[model samples]
Structure formats: structure tokens, C-alpha cells
Target chain A: MSVLVVIECANGEVKKSSLEAATYGSKVAQQMGTTATAIAIGDISEENLKHLGAQGIKKVLFDNDARLKNFVNLAYVKVIAAAAQKEDSKVIILSNTNIGAAIGSRLAVRLEASLATNVVALPEISGSTFKVKRGVYSGKAFAEVNLTSDRKIIAVKKNTIEVGHEAGEASVENFSASLTDADFAAAPKEVIQQTGDILLPEADIVVSGGRGLKGPENWHLVEDLAKALGAATACSKPVADVDWRPHHEHVGQTGITVSPNLYIAIGISGAIQHLAGVNSSKVIVVINKDPEAPFFKAADYGIVGDAFEVVPKLIEAAKQLH
Target chain B: MKILVCISNVPDTTTKITFTPDNKQFNTAGVQFVINPYDEYALTRAIELKEAQGGTVTVLNVGEADTEANIRKALAIGADDAIRVNAKPTDAFFVATQIANIAKQENYDLILMGKESVDYNGFQVHGMVAEMLGIPSITPGVKLDVNGNTATVQREIEGGHEIIDAQLPIVVSAQQPMCEPRIPNMRGIMTARTKPLKVVEPTGSATKTEIDAFSLPPQKTGVKMISPENAGELITLLRNEAKVI
Candidate 1:
């Protein structure tokens, strides 16, 4: 039995979350006294596939099907399931991304494996039992889950596990599932990706804004500070609801959850819903004109000053650091 | 077009989360339950579609009797009828199985739900149900429009979005900006009291996973305040002390 890691790639490069998954899968493989093999999907180069070795993967399986470039839920599931069966994998790991969650859930049903998503830690295996800790209730709490099935599927939340770089190179092998036309039935007609901005979920640092930033016209304050820190930009739910930002940039209980290394909240009041999405950041910095803002309680550092004044100074300081 | 919109009754977003003494289950004693905020998007969109086109919208839930209030709230909002699978929603697979069985028997043209429930936050049921029913599923859908036998969906990705097309009999999980969730009117609420709410026994007998315990996240000790004039010091602390910069 082996561990199978599903590596998601876009535009010929591996996503940071998938790299974390590879590392987590390798650790799980080590704990089970087995090896980890990665099944890479999308239009990634073989050279990039071999880089999984840094995450402790021993072998890389690449399917160079042109049709597999974009995500097709059923097609990806068939390919991953084929890889798992071929390797006789007892444990399957994937990053808890939109694509990953889609494939992992379907694979669990098809393979009769117990599935867990938003898993925050590695599994604890003792004898026949496998247990994992996962965030639940929108990160307000966590649950320790026991997987009772013979086979298991885990979707690790991004930024929770630390990525490790070990010395080695993984051997790349070609694999095919012989996908049919039906597999491409639901393929996307057009995909529009943001060209230059850092993706919020994968960013190491995030700078977010709220209604206190005044209007969409004044959003450059948030962006300027983000640029200084080399961070991604985000906003609370209200900011997105009023068209100040796109829905994808909204981080809250009802939106994307991020766990970056640092989260800077400017003018955001730290609503519980908003906090649910960002409270997992390693360090939180809150800046608001209101001294009694709820976000201050959850923040590592707080500055009770106008964003109009504080953010520009912070940007200046960040620029002068190096 | 017959649409099945799944809803979950969860604690209000502002509720303070707590666990029982044993920590095996959530402490719901004082928590006020409402229709999950995300699912409301799905419910509202489904209602709007039903209004635009000519079809019936049915609301489904996997919960006990306590969930019926939210189920009724859904009915009041716009659904024609409701179904509550008499079960605890043990796990994603179990819940998906229940949903799939009903969809298979009824042959719903569209299955709609939130991307994930707020309570367990398991974003698995939609795909699991779609797989079980041999249908295509789109998740975190920001926009959905139906024309004839084809359905168009705008699905959210990491940085942007994708426009996808699928034939009839598709599953979609809704996200924000889809539509503003509607509140039930007095007339609708009065009519909802008479709407059919069928409670059926769960067909799935097995669950793949079990929750061992629940725990709260560690709280921040306290915030280190910085004077407004020394705002730049915060960045210095982030670099030197926190080492995060």
C-alpha cells in the first residue's frame, strides 16, 4: 500500500497549496512506513513534476492529455482514481482547493473511502484507526474525526502545514486513464484568471480593507500598503457586497478562508464572520480609528488611528525596511 | 425545470460557539438557528429561477424535527414544498446519499445547495451527490442561468472565475453575488404553514467517519497597542520581533 498525493497545477506551475499537500502526504507516508507518489494534473512540465522530490515524493505520475489542461471534475476524478488503483494506495491526500474538494468528494464515493476536508493536521494512526483534526464551524472550533474506512482521503487546508524541502529528485512516469468524450462534457468554455495580483488563499501576507476605507475610489490605500508588504489584497463582506471589491476578494464565513503568515486589517471592524475566515493567520495586525473595534481583541498588534494617516506611514516604513 | 435546493440549519453567524461538556457535539442550548447564510443564496436563486421559468422548487434538509423551522422558513421564502430526511446528517457521504436517493427517484433537473454548510463546513455533499447520480457538479457558483436544456454557470476559482456549460440534470453549489437572499413576506409565511413538509426516514445506514471531540481555537493573549504617531513601529515589530515580514 502507498500514499497518493494529488498535485494541482495551473499555467505549467504547481500551486503553493498543492506543495503543502505534497509535504503533508509525504509525512503521512513516512508515518505509515510507506512511500508517497504524486499524481500531477493540468499543463505542467515534467521538470516541474520532478520537483515534487523536494516534498519527499519518490515518484511522479504525469498525464499529458491536452484535454486535462483545464479542470474537468469527472475526468480528474477518473485519472486520480486510476492512479490510486494502479498504486494500490490506501491513503490519498490533496489540497482543499475548489478543484481538490470537487475531486476528493467524488473519489471518496467511487472508491468507498472516508473523506475529510479542511483537515488542519496530520493523521494519528494507531493500529487500524486513523484520526485527523479539522477546522469546523467556520474556524470557530475544530473537530477530531475518526475515519473508519479501510481507505482514506484527506484534503489539507492551505497554509496550515509547513512545506519542507528535502534533498532528492523524483522519477517521472507517464500515465493515462484513456478518458472519453463524456469526461469533458462540463469543461469550461472560458476561464478568466487575474493576471498579476497575488491570489489571496496562497499569499504569505494579506492586507485587507473595509467600509472605513470610504469608497472603491479610495481603495488605493489598501493596495498601496499591500504593494509595500508584497501582500495580496482582500476585503470584508460588506466591502464586496457594495461593489467596492469582487466577491473573490471577500474573506469571511461565507467567503474564502485564508490562513496566511500575516494578516493586516485596515478599517475592518473584525466581525465574527470576517474573523472566521482570517483568524487562522499566524499574526494579525489591526488598524482602525475606533479604539474599541472587536478586531483588536484578536490582533497581535493594534493601532487606533485613521487609516488615512496610519496606512501611508506603514507603507513608508515597509518600503524603507530593505 | 424541477429544482432541489438543499438547506442546512446552523447557528447564527454571530453566535458564540461552544461545545458540550464531553465536547462531542456543539452546544446548541442558547444558539439561535437560522438558514445557513450561503444556502440562502442557493434558495433565493432557485426561487428566482422558478419564477423566471415555470417549475417547482423543493427544499431538502437532512436533520431532525428542530430543523423544520428553518425548512419552513425556506418554504416561506419561495420553495413549493419541503423534505426533511429524518437523520442527523452523520457525515458528508451519508447526507449525499440521502440527497442522491431522492434526486434519483424524482429525477430533479437541477440540484442546488450552498458550497458548504456553515456548521460542519464540509464542502463535499454536492460533488458526492453528483457523482452518485452520474451528473456534473459545479461548486461555489457565483452566477447561474438556465436556457432550454443547457445550464450556464460561473464558477469561482483561485484568482478569477470560469464560465462553464452543462446539459440538464446538473448539480450546483451557490456562493455570494449570485443573488440577494430574500426574506419571507407575511403572505408567504402564512402560506408556508400549509405547504407540504414531508419527513422521510433516511435510507443510508452507514457513516464513514465519526467526530471524536470538539475544541475552540486558541485566543490571542492581548494586543500590543502602538501610538498613532509611531505607526511605523508596527512594521518594525513585524520584521524584527514577529519575523513575519
Candidate 2:
């Protein structure tokens, strides 16, 4: 009857990927001739929840529980289920994030809904059938999946759908799930937030380095270029493996997958696994001393040169643009 | 401790993905299958725990006969035994149901698996199975250590990571940096041949989702080669032509 969207907020601001989920949910609601309702967990301002209307949500449900601010899987699932029951929601939409994956799968079992994750496109509904396209094979291929259950859950991949801005404002309502102590059992004992100007998954432009940078000492070239471009810094798996960078910054098949607007690879050979992680970027620039590097084939632009000489010039040129 | 580690057989990471003519199923012809890289972490960690704590590690897979080879490989890597539910993993829900049913019968103290299968990339099984069995699930755990009945798991979040502690009977999905996946030695491989491999009929037939088709991603046109001397020109083109800078 209705579409429910899970809007994730941190420090009182909605995450960029959740905004896209809101937009995708609203569009699905429109196609179903119903309105989209959003259920937000944790500590978020009412003003910020109301802003969900800009993404086509008509109603925003907020459970202002302090414990929910950090992700407690059971508690979050119970609250979202309560909202879905209240709204008679037939479809649930969420971003395919770490929290979303934990919540969506459990929610699917709890609600007996058909579940799909890593979905990249809208559902094609024909009569009783609802099919969605999702990225499979580590971004190498796509799979069109049909949700057979009456209730459906979709986890949208980041940077795949465009967020919409509409004129209307959503009405914020207080929602209470009456969670208990048992729900918080698996809550995190400690949360460590990465100290960086830009997060790789949310950044529009990403500057990544690889083993070609030679050593961690020369990482300043990659960082300088990233700083000049105002982009997030990433590296290949080998760099992360050798303790040159944190695993969070590694973008490859087994690492974090990024789909930024622009991805600049410095000194990184384009390995198949690495390409699998970043091939979704809109524009790819490869800078490597080996002109025959396989990465050049997948890149949109290539400048064959040594990173020691080329990165500084690129940084200077990027700075001049400002 | 009775640890159950689930593994999936998938195409080699470098395998060229292709679909059948109708595009409804993956073309497995001539493609070599390996134990999913992520699941290797879980298997190795379980083996390490078994060795240190003196417990049994069982490797489980929800697949047909074709997947038995990879299941044997997991046993070769040091699982005490292996279980194969004879069914094609149609969807995450169905697979979870099968796993939950077996876990309910066996009563595993710890359940381990990959964060997601590289083939389908469905990060759902661990949570779903945990929910089905009425237990806690921690996912993409980069680090895990167990002391008595309690498990301390470090899981990845958006910007960073979180460390959480849960009681026994918890499901944990492994990510990288958890442990170095082990390769089977000749002695282990010989023992794996005699290891008890149990194949049971799938307990459930209901699947929540169905695959309709498969397609490859759009190919990139040729790369625009820029002179290393005119590196700045690349920036101009990115700003003007690509409009993505």
C-alpha cells in the first residue's frame, strides 16, 4: 500500500547515499500511485528529518532514541518494522551500506519479504511481477532479479541513482518502538570515526595511489594531488596490505568499492581485481610510468609518466584551476 | 566450540563473466570455480580457532554436486568435516533458510561466513540466518577473537570501524585482515579425501527472489592519451569536456 524508506543520519545530517535511497523510494511510490514515508532512527533533528520532503518523502518518522544513534541491529530493525506495520508498507528501500545490509537482511527474515541488495536500477513492475537490476560479479555484470514475496525490500547501491529535489516539505512525526535492554545487547562497545576531510564512498572525486608510488614515504605526491582536487585519498590492495595505508582506503575487488564521478589512479597498475572495484566511476584517469599497464585500457584518459614528476605538475595544474 | 563456516563456490576473480544465450543464467562453461576469497578468511579463522581452543570446525555449502569440489577444498584447508545441501542457491533468503535449519539441528556455537559472495554480491545470508535462528549477527568483521562464551568482533562501518562483543551462538561475516587464508598442504589434501562429506536434501523449496537475466557493464571507449609533458592539458579536458573535475 505504501513505500517505506530508511533514512540514515549521522551527527544530525542525512547521509548522501540515504538521500539517493529516499529519491529512489519516492519514485517507486509514484509508480505505485502511493506516497513514500521515511523512518529515521537515532539522534536526528526534526528540521533535518523534515528535509526528507525535498527528496519526495511525504512523511518522516523519527525515533529519537540516544542508543539508536549508534547502530544496534536488533533495535533498528524493530523500529523500522514498527513503522512499516503502521504505514502498511509493501516495499522498503534503503541504501546498500554496512548498516543497511545488516538491517535489511534481518528485516527481510523478520517481515518475510523478498530481499535484494546492490540494486542499481528501479523495479520493472508488470502486473504481479517486480524485477530489479543489481550489480553482480563484483561489478563486472548485472542481474535482473524478480522479488516474489508480497513484501519487498531493496538496498540501493551508492552513487547509482540521482537524488531528487522537490518543493514540498515532509511532516515529521514522533515514532516509538518501545525497545528494551535486550535489543541493545549487540551494541558497539567502541566506535572509531575515520579522521579525514572526505570519505571515499561519499566523495565526488577520488585520488588513489598504488604500489607504483614505491613507498609510503612518497605518498605525499598522492595526497598533494588529492588535496589540490579536494578529493578523497585511496590506494590499491597491495599498499593496504603492506601497512602503507589503512584497509578502509583500499579500493579493489576485496576492498571498498567506489563509484565517484572522477577517479584518478597514480602509480597503480590496473589489475583486474582493482578495476572490478573502481570500474563504475564516471571518468577514470591513469598515471603510470608503464605505458603498457593494463589500467590504461580501462581509463578514460592516460598520461604515461613517472608519478614523482607527473603528480606534482598535475597538483599544480589542479591548484591553478581554483 | 562447534564452529560452522559457510563457503560458496564462485568463478575465479579473473574469470571473464558471461551469461547464457537467454541471459537468464550464468555460463559456467570452461570457468574454473574456487572457494570465494572472502569465505577463505572465515574458513582460516575458524581453523585457527579450532586449533587453539580444541574444537570442531565444519564447512557448509548450499549448492549442488558441482560445488562439492570446493567443499572438499575447504576440508582440505582444515575443516573437520563438510556438509553440502544439494540445491542450487536460488536466492539469499532460501540459502539462509537452509543454513538456519541445519544450524538449528546441529546447534553451532559460532557461525562464520563471508561478508558477501563475490558472484551475486548479496550481503544477506549471515543476517538472515542469525535472525532465523534468533541470534545476533555481526557483519564484515575485520577482526574477531573469542574468549569462552563471548566474542569480540571488529566490524567496518562507513567512515571507520566498530568493535562489539556478543555472546555465543552469534553469526559473524568475515572481511579481509581477519586472517590469512590458508592453502591446503599435501598432507591435508590427502586427509581431505577421507573426511566425512555429508550431502543432504535441501529442507526448503521456497525462494523469495528469482533471476531474470544477466548483462555485462558498458565497455569504455579507447583511452585518450595525453602527453606527459602537457599533463595540465588533461586537467583542462577533465574540467571542460568531461565536466567531472
For all candidates, state DockQ relative to the true structure: 0.89, 0.86
- In the range B9-113, model 1's lDDT, one tens digit per residue, is 889999889998999889989889999998999999999999999899999999999999999999999899999999988899899999999999999999999
Model 1 chain B weakest 10-residue run by lDDT: B156-165
lDDT of 1 by residue, A1-322 (tens): 8899999997789999999999999999999999999999878999988888999999999998888888888899999999999999999999988988889889999999999999999999999989999999998999999999999999999886888799999999999898888898899999999889888888999999999999999889899889889999999999999898988899989988999999999999999999999988999999999999999999999999999999899989999976
On residues B146-228, what C-alpha lDDT tens digit does candidate 2 reach at each position? 99999999999888889999989899999989998899999999999999999999985999999888999998999999988
Compared with the true structure, what per-residue lDDT tens digits does model 2 show for residues A1-322? 6899998887679999999999999999999999999999886899988888999999998998877888889999999999999999999999999999999999999999999999988999989999999999998999999999999999998887888988989999999898888788789999988775688888899999999998999999988989999999999999999999988899988898899999999999988999999998999999999989999989999999988888888998999999
Q: How does model 2 fare in lDDT? A: 0.93
Native interface contact recovery, all models: 0.87, 0.85
Tell me the deviation in Å of residue A215 in model 1.
Answer: 1.4
- The true-versus-predicted C-alpha distance at residue A202 of model 1, in Å, is 1.0
Worst 10 residues of 2 chain A by lDDT: A193-202
